[model samples]
Target: MSFGAQVLGTLGGIVVATLGGTLVYGAIRLTVGLRLDQEDEYNGADLSIHKISATPERESLG
Candidate 1:
């Protein structure tokens, strides 16, 4: 193959790989976000690891 054709092919491959990776990452993030949202709605906090308040009052600095 010609040098130009090889370079173009390499670039195309890289672009496709990057897009696929980005899509996978986005899908994972969306799934996680949805699960978390559902947990918040049903249980008020994430319970996979431990049960804790989603919001706790913090000491104010005055």
Candidate 2:
């Protein structure tokens, strides 16, 4: 393909990806949820959700 065609194709692909991501994120946000609360976030997912740290030796980041 020509250079112009390649460029257009790349741009089109990027637009499609962006739109798809936005839609998926919007749906998820409307549904259950996307993120954790302040305390859970500070504790991290491994501890907050699983009740155990992935790295036992090192403490939580916060």
Candidate 3:
């Protein structure tokens, strides 16, 4: 309840969250992967992942 206690709690929370996020991200990167290939990036996520265009009519106009 005191100011010192509140500050300490906030710092502890930040440290815990940062470490937890780093571990989870590292695990995913080592396993299923985290980044897309160049073709996936250029074609876009909507087409690569979902196998469909997000806006086919509008895209054709350009």
Candidate 4:
């Protein structure tokens, strides 16, 4: 009903959401893991998954 109450409610919602998301991701990391392996990390995600560089650069002055 008041501007101050609205702001406080929004801030509280954000804090709860952030903590909930962190807990979910932490559980997943502990069980399945979340990252690229050595070779994949070295090669980069685009080259590994899409078979192309994320940013292609032409070396010509045309």
Most accurate candidate by TM-score: 3
For each candidate, the alpha-carbon lDDT, in order, equals: 0.73, 0.91, 0.94, 0.89
- Candidate 1 on 1-29: residue-level lDDT in tens? 89999999999999999999999989998
Give the clashing residue pairs of candidate 2, or none: none
Model 4 clash pairs?
Answer: none
> What's model 1's TM-score?
0.52
Model 2 scores worst on lDDT over the 10 consecutive residues at 53-62
Ranking by TM-score: 3, 2, 4, 1
- Candidate 2 ranges beyond 4 A from true positions: 57-62
Higher-TM-score candidate of 3 and 4: 3
Query: What lDDT score goes with residue 54 in model 3?
Result: 77
**Candidate 1 residue 48 C-alpha distance from true site, Å:** 7.4
Best by lDDT: 3
Q: Backbone clashes in each candidate structure, one number apiece?
A: 0, 0, 0, 0
Task: TM-score each candidate.
Answer: 0.52, 0.68, 0.83, 0.57
lDDT of 4 by residue, 8-56 (tens): 9999999999999999999999997798789989989998878988775
- What is the RMSD of candidate 3? 1.6
Task: For model 2, state the Cα shift of residue 55 in Å.
Answer: 4.0
RMSD for each of the candidates: 5.9, 3.8, 1.6, 3.6
Candidate 1 backbone collisions, by pair: none
lDDT of 2 by residue, 13-45 (tens): 999999999999999999978998999999899
